[model samples]
Target: MMDLLRSLLFVLLFYPGTLLYVLTVIIVSPIGDAPVQAVVHAWSQFHHWLVRNVLGIRIVWDGAIPDGPFLIAVKHQSMMEAVDTLHFAQCPVVVMKRELTVIPLFGWVTRRYGVIGVDREAGASALRTMMAEARAAVSGGRPVIIFPEGTRVPYGTSPPLRPGFAGLYRALGLPVVPVAHDVGRLWHRGFVKRSGTVHFKVGDVIPPGLKRDDVESRVHAAINALTP
Candidate 1:
């Protein structure tokens, strides 16, 4: 089928393209953050091009992308939004699992690029470290993005957020911006991606200093507003 062929081509092109981009990042990393950031932007743009032309998918933004530093809690449905975040935000500090930050060359590049890796199994220690890094990122005027649900879930399913979200919320004391999207409908955890529009709906900003239960409930609801 056309979808299968397109998917195959996409994989073939994406991996090699990513390798080149990674290498570029590694090379420019020593120069300064600006050069590295430029490479990352180009890489994200490349992904957008492939998704639109090769996979026949379109990304539709429903609301304005935030410009200032804030805690961005996004709904994680698939890898599409993971990469797309680079395109939507201006020099965002993404919080990802420590495992991802340990990958060979990619890991080093990620650390150099300012990604905050979270050790999920490290319990309270991990939260402390993540909060520390998030504070630094916010002070630098870069938005910190995290998947509140911790991991990707199937379409139409909304899970409770991980505990670290509230801890980070309290520590950073920054307003939270919830982003809702339906990427799994066309780009689930497999090959042969379907062609359609992936809607990215940005919810209103939630101010800081609310009760843990209240903030969690509001973010959970906002991020899943477009789920069903």
Candidate 2:
């Protein structure tokens, strides 16, 4: 009923909104990366507004966003949070699968945005390549955001993180900021975006140099600590 209408409205509006932002990106691309990112940030902001006003969805941030260059290991539940990161992070270099880079305009602009794309099936060599790119991104003083689970997990379920997360942590030697959120409840992995507040709870910064097992255990617990 209403859910279907809201969902349909969300889908209809999204196409135009994305097109508008893509046009902005094209117009500002000649100016440089910073301006282009500003355009993307504006789009994310608009998305937030649409979610709040049109879809009756709200986003609440419950913890501090770390300062300086670091790695952000996020709980991947929905695309909403991914869009939100464009606004939340100072300047983020997202580590994504190589497949996403072929997504028409999204792929083209994200490459221009300097996102690191990796072929996940490539094994150790891919890990090395990912770390190298992430290192370069952080070197520029921007944060790197990675989905620990490597893909979206359904709401209320926690999955073991992929090895790449630990690999990057060890290779980069930077504090890992674990960000947890229950966005799946609202912006589902399927469709049917529900109406409610999505809470982004940032946990304590996990210091670098921990053993792989320790790092994974700590981050896994910290991210899933959010209640209500």
Candidate 3:
């Protein structure tokens, strides 16, 4: 119950600030002066700070960003993990569910920035679309982030990752950075509250020159190798 109350309090502060940010995005992105992508990316960073502060999550930066464009396959623990990426990476155009675009202002913001949507039910067509987007993002000097598990899994328990992850790595042909961490305990589910540090450890990058068609097994192995 205390966590719920805290979350509500946080929401109160966040909503008003978010509204202001949304308005700024509208003003800046519409005019010719500011590039839409840069403005939105800035907003994402600020938004990350807002949530981190409200939730009392102190983000510790460790490791280095790969020298070239790469693919970032991260373990999804909570919504915070998704938001935190904006701070560390301007690259890694995130791959997310298509339905997120349906959200009001936030959806518009994500689209204007760097998120790529994939329809879960579209099967082969979705795979094709993901390949194209992932490849383009990597080729254009942005790392592409894929949640191999497809959805957020609470801490300590593993969710079986989807098979498409391998295909994405193969199709993109870039270094793969495997990110893993336990953030679920920080942002617990249901009607309670707790606050703590969330450590996101970014592991080594898988370099190019692997068998092109063998993307699936390689992606699965690398993700599994990430220490919990």
Q: Give the number of the best model, judged by lDDT.
A: 1
Cα deviation of 39, candidate 1, in Å? 0.6
Candidate ranking under TM-score, highest first, comes to 1, 2, 3
Collision pairs in model 1: none
Query: How badly does each model clash, as a count of residue pairs?
Result: 0, 0, 4
Candidate 1 positional error at 215, Å: 0.7
Writing each residue's lDDT as its tens digit, candidate 2 over 193-222 gives: 788787888999999999999999999987
For residues 24-52, write the lDDT of model 1, one tens digit per residue.
99888889999998998898889889999
Alpha-carbon lDDT of model 1: 0.90
Could you tell me how far off, in angstroms, the CA of residue 184 lies in candidate 2 after the best superposition? Answer: 1.0
Query: Which of the two, 1 or 3, has more TM-score?
Result: 1
**Ranking of all candidate structures by their lDDT, best first:** 1, 2, 3
**Candidate 2 Cα misplacement greater than 4 A, ranges:** none
Instruction: Give per-model TM-scores.
Output: 0.97, 0.94, 0.84
Q: Give residue 49's error in model 1 in angstroms.
A: 1.3
